[model samples]
Target chain A: MSEKFSLSIEDLHVSYQLSGSAGKNKIARAVDGVSLQLHPGETLALVGESGSGKTSIANAVMRLLEPTSGKILLDGVDLVPLQGSELRAMRRNFQMIFQDPFESLDPRQRVIETVMEPLEIHGIGENQEQRRDLALAALAQAGLRPAADIGDRFTHQLSGGQRQRVAIASAIILKPSLIIADEPVSMLDVSLRAGILRVMADLRDQLGVSYLFITHDLSLAWMFADRIAVIYLGRIVEEASAVDLIENPMHPYTKALVSVIPVPEAIEGASRTILSGEIPSPSSIPSGCRFHPRCPLFRELGEPEKCLNEDPLLQISAKSESHLVACFFSDPSKGDTQ
Target chain B: MSLLEIRDLHVSYPNRKGEFFAVDGVDLTIEQGEFVGLAGESGCGKTTLALSIPQLLPEHSRIAAGSISFNGVDTTALNEEGLRAIRWKEISVIFQGALNALNPVQTIGSQIQEPIRIHDESVSKKEAQDRTLELLEAVGIPSHRASDFPHQFSGGMRQRVMIAMALSCMPKLVIADEPITALDVMTQAQILDLLRSLCDKYKLSMLLISHDLSVLAQTCDRVAVMYAGKVAEQGPTSRVFGSVGAQHPYTQRLLRAYPNIRHERKFIDGIPGYPPDLSTLQVGCRFADRCDVALSRCATEVPDLIDIGGNQSVACHLVSENQVGVQ
Candidate 1:
């Protein structure tokens, strides 16, 4: 059990029983033995490509899906044992903002109504007028100036950035201690992404809420996140602070991800390690190391038998700078960068 | 003559409010074997400009003014049949989300060979097959995998198949509209590298359209920024996006909004306004409402693109005034 943490996921394993194949006994482990912690007012980014089980972890923590095993603790309280009405009550302590705001928000509802519905469900205000005032305040905090006038418009009437802000206002109206944002700004254009991310960061400071920010972009994580965790095949291969991970990536997968980030300058002769293949299907994971099939480091070492046979657990790096890695060859000083 | 040239091009679509000129008096040029990037936010008309070059405009849209010339031939005057004759063998397009447009029931090999065989009646079956295999290899896909169906391949592989098909006819110019927008970063880098190498090998010109300026900066030789259906700025990628920096306010703000790992991390406000509506009345400047530095005359008088030395052109009143003062 963790002490005084906002959210702690211990040895989380989320698996699904595959249907119509392998005698109905085959199970696909979407999130296999993942552990993470978020302090109060902290932002931890789970970075990976598609099918890396970051979504599964988020869904499990939000209790949208039941995990196969392991405990999810919120403020030192285990969430796995709650049931029925108790589970519904526990949802008030946490909130979620999905990737696509258009799909998440209803077109028929007005912007103010959408933000007020959460307060009504949670019974936060004494009456309708009070709830409207609270909703307006949240909208103003979300950078929607003259919040009352903007709230009168329908969701369809607002721009993409404004719609995302409305969604954030709804998520933060309940004043949840923890928030889960799953690719929240990926749908918006590059120019509009900063506005949405800035609103989310500001909300954290004012409300003292912890954030579980999940994204596939390393640059966004490095720019916004306090800590970065590299997720590969449902496991954390590397974990470190944002500056530490981007400046000194030890894991081979993390190095490949950091190298592929496009800079806004015309950098000449800058070579990026293009991973050979896409992330393997979660259903048919590789034998030992999930990333060995497409890893450049594994092939560079002449296909070591240990990589093919022995699964490496997440361990501290050789330097032991609070940086964690699950790789046999992870010396940034040696310049594992290719 | 240049590979593709547009002179005062104007494109408009009918709306309830009025006629929306999506592309308004824009001019650009692409030489043979050059990689050009067209960037802007959504509804900024970069996609419209890219789609119009190959005469792939929607049925509702019309060419209101100006002309599009391909290799000294006026494409605007070409009939549908004449345009068909010029397509594929001369100008091909790789559209966005085209990976999902792959034929599900057909083998990728036959799909690549279809263009080669249809465009040339004299080519034999074996020649078409050989060309298909060669294109697959050029795009870094193994020849044997060509027999696989679209469902069997991943998203990146299916994109590679689309590229192979686009080059099957050996077109002189290929227009890729947001080619790698949906792929992961690693896959995007691989596809970008593949496109660069393939363009060099085939000696063809490319017009890559995307909303991400960082992507355009890295992949394009020259970058053009669009706003409110007009080209705000365009120049060599190094001068426009590099340390020398873009002269236009829209381009400068767009570059500032992007997240770059190479630079110090700081929170950005991201151009504090909505994208301009295309249906609004034609004015001096479409981006004037959102621009931070705007003159009083910007709302009344239109500013045309002026070439300010160093192969750069900007359509801003302040820039032109500064240029006059410098002279």
Candidate 2:
């Protein structure tokens, strides 16, 4: 365990047992042996398609769902074993921002009440007055100017962007060490998305808050995240700096995912690698290399038997220590591998 | 000849306070086999404008003035029965949210065949089924799975089914409203490719409505940027999105907000403040409150869409004045 890291997940595994109609038992490995580390004030984005277990990892870290096996360590404390008041106490160190601001925020609660509820639940301030003052300051920090006026309006009265600002205000009011934002801007309009992203970035710089930003938009991940982790099914297929991942993606899935992102400028004669089929269900995960069924490179390599027999571990590349890829065929030294 | 021409079209709905213009004075035209995209934020009335094309507005809503001319015919003056003649035979719609648009209790084939049967009663059941199979295959869905229910398919597959349904009647113009919004990036690309190819093969005109500027930039031949029920800018996709130049500050801001993979990290400035309320009377520019380069006159004078040559038009006092001076 590194002391420099603010949050670390060691071999996290979350599974759900399901009973079939014929009384057969099956296990869905939502988070299958995933591990990640986030430095203080660092932004790490988990980019994947839906049903790729990104939300499950966030849920496990928030202690909303129990992990079958793994260590969720925040500041050297293993949160997997913590429960009751201890878990509640640990929750104060981390907060979450959800996708839909309208659904996440209570319609009846005013902006001030929503932001102050966190402080009240944690029993941080002495009374309502102090909490209200802190909430107002947080609102201003979130770029909602004239905080007192904006704080008086209810969630329904505010725009989608304003509601999201309120949500950010609530998340940062606690001054948590880490914030897990799940598609925070996906629900908002395209123009409003950048504003929320900027707020999150500024908060990290000012308060030294780390972020585990989960989103399906890879382009957004490239724009904001310092480090990008591409997840497939329940495992991290590739993890590298944003620049490295976007410019030099190694995993076959990462390459395909990056190729499909619609850029504003049309690159003439640019051929895209479109994967053939949808992501397989978590309950029926393929054996060996999980992505081998849809791996265009694997088929191009004459159906390598090794990919069908051995599952690849996420291994650091020889070129860069920070760049890791979970594929045997992604050796950058070989010119033909890419 | 233009396939669809909307001139100063205004749609309004009465509320507790008064009538609110959802689709205010807007002029748009789509040539034969042209793909025109309408891009805007939510509640900016892009959907309302698209819905008004087929006269699908709600009961409370009414077309206040102007005209919608399709194929040299005035569509706004058509009655329900008259409109039905052109609805599926000439124009069709692929609505948002494929999951809800499809009926769960019915098979995909039946839903697709309904349009074909309604449009042309002479077609036999077997021929309709064959056409349904062909439509399904065209959308990249396996023909054997035509009997499958909506729930049996993936999100992308359901979207394909929706496209297949929209194309069953072979309409000349298809209005696709956010066809791939919720799907993954890969699926979105596939859907867009399918749409482009289908439009080309059928020589069909399309009106694609989405909040995503990148999607519009990639798909549409020409783009119309709407803000608060007005067309802020309209031009060729290359000029509007590419370096040729975007005249409107709103369009520029929208283009900047989207992260382009080809470009390096650039500062994205969000347009401050929410869109102005539609129910309230507006005398000047709707985007003046958020416009960074707005002049004092901008708050008092509403600018009309002015042509800046090269098939580009803008509705901003700043850009129009600059262009007029240059000319």
Backbone clashes, each candidate: 0, 0
User: What TM-score do all the candidates reach, one by one?
Assistant: 0.95, 0.96
Measured against the true two-chain complex, the DockQ scores of the candidates, in the order shown, are 0.76, 0.67
Instruction: For residues B1-327, write the lDDT of model 1, one tens digit per residue.
Output: 888899999999999976889998889999999999999988888878888887899999988999999999999999988898778989999988898999899999999999998989999999999999999999988899879899888888899999999998999999998999888788899999898888888888998898888888888899888888888999999888775688998888988887778878777558867776768666777778888899999988888888998889999998999999999
Please name the candidate that would achieve the greatest DockQ relative to the true structure: 1
Error of 2 at A3 (Å): 4.0
Best by TM-score: 2
Q: For residues A1-338, could you state the per-residue lDDT of candidate 2 as single tens digits?
A: 33677889999999988786732587888889999999999999999999899999999999989999999999878999998999899998998999999899999988899899989889999988999999999999999989999999888999888899999999999899999999999988877888899999999999999999999999889888999999999999999999899999989999999888877664555678988789988888898899999999889899888789889999897769999999988775644442
Clashing pairs in 1: none
Q: List per-prediction Cα lDDT, in the order shown.
A: 0.89, 0.90
lDDT of 1 by residue, A169-220 (tens): 9999888899999999999987789889988988888899999999998988
Q: Name the runs in model 2 displaced over 4 angstroms.
A: A20-24, A334-338, B16-18
